[model samples]
Target: MRPELEPGHVAVVTGGARGIGLAVVEALGARGVGVLCVDHPDADTSAFVAACEAAGVAHAVASLDVRDRDAVRAGVATAADLGPVAYAVNCAGVDGLHPASGMTADEWRRVVQVDLDGVMFACQAEHDLLAGRGGSIVNIASMSGHVVNRGVTHAAYSAAKAGVIHLGRSLAVEWAPLGIRVNSVSPGYTMTAMTATNPPEVNAGFAAQTPMGRLAEVEEVAEPVVFLLGRRASFVTGTDLLVDGGFTAW
Candidate 1:
């Protein structure tokens, strides 16, 4: 176990079934934090549970869609059964690549509800649980929130992510007095299941444009999130950490 996180501390990770969320869950579990992995009913939650068990970490799994307020509240309540939730990572989100003119209302609403509203729902629940414990939250925004993507017309996604960043900043101030810290992590062109289906040339072009000439690995992003959740970042709050491999440098 990592020296920063000792056993018995609990951390709840939304979208923990896979990708960056899964990586964060693993990182926390490896550090001896009891993890509560929340995801949609359709996600491969068994895999996450298996991984946690393999890491010799205590964990629980909940099938939840973060967009559902009642479900989110209930999930957080259930997480308390394990221990105090010392950290909450909001990583459940969706991406829509439709042109602004062609995007439908439902599509726009779905993206916003999942990315923005869902974040609020999770944060509120987790904040309630961590009220006196002085836990931290790490919301997963994106580089798209800070910069426009000319190749993809992800207007809805970009707008929602922008809201997430602002929401994190606001929560940081609102919760600071309560001893709760809030922050955000914005990633750029990371390879994931969603990006795996993107055009090979498009992905290559994005990597080429990065100063590092590569996409960030899931672990690279997870490490910062873990740091924020630990005491090492005790004084940090209301800030956005960009882990884009210098993609935003230009």
Candidate 2:
């Protein structure tokens, strides 16, 4: 293990089954950090564990839904079995687009419940994990939290992510005294499974708007997220690391 990370130090990553979440898991594991991969109960975790092991790292898997309060708390305890969870990333979320005027109550509630509420739940659960060791948390937010998109109707998503950004800042201040740091990583349009469902034309449209002239890759976003969780970001807290392709720069 690295000097900054002890033998038993572990990282708990939500939505670790795939996409940006899985990318983060691999990044941490490759660095010899113990990992607790949490995702849906039915998600295939064998590949993830194998990948970690291939990198000469310890790994554990847990079935959980960030929306379930009890599950989130228990999931942390479960992860602690591997080691002290000194690093955590709240990356579990749902993706959708619905205009506010036509959005159904269920649609709005579901998005917020998973995106915003799940983050809060995960944070509360990880608090105990970092109580003694002191740690860092990085919540995966989105650019929608800052600016609306051209074709995607992300009204609900925007509102929920906006909440995540603010909540992370608040927690950073509250946990600073305890030697714990909290921050958010707001990625712009990223090319991942989550965005794979969009129409090709829609994706192209977003590409046109971004200052970088393209969507971010999953690895690109994961790199910054892992950076925030590492010792390199020891003094970084209560801030949002924008990994967007300068989507909001305009």
User: Per-candidate RMSD vs. true structure?
Assistant: 1.4, 1.7
Model 1, 107-129: lDDT tens digits are: 99999999999999999999889
lDDT of 1 at 161: 93
lDDT score, candidate 2: 0.86
What would the per-residue lDDT of candidate 2 be over residues 101-137, giving only the tens digit for each residue?
Answer: 9999999889999999999988998998897879999
| Cα TM-score per model | 0.97, 0.95
Which 10-residue window of candidate 1 scores lowest in summed lDDT? 1-10
Residue 83, candidate 1: Cα error in Å is 1.5
In candidate 1, list every pair of residues with a backbone clash: none
Clashes of each: 0, 0
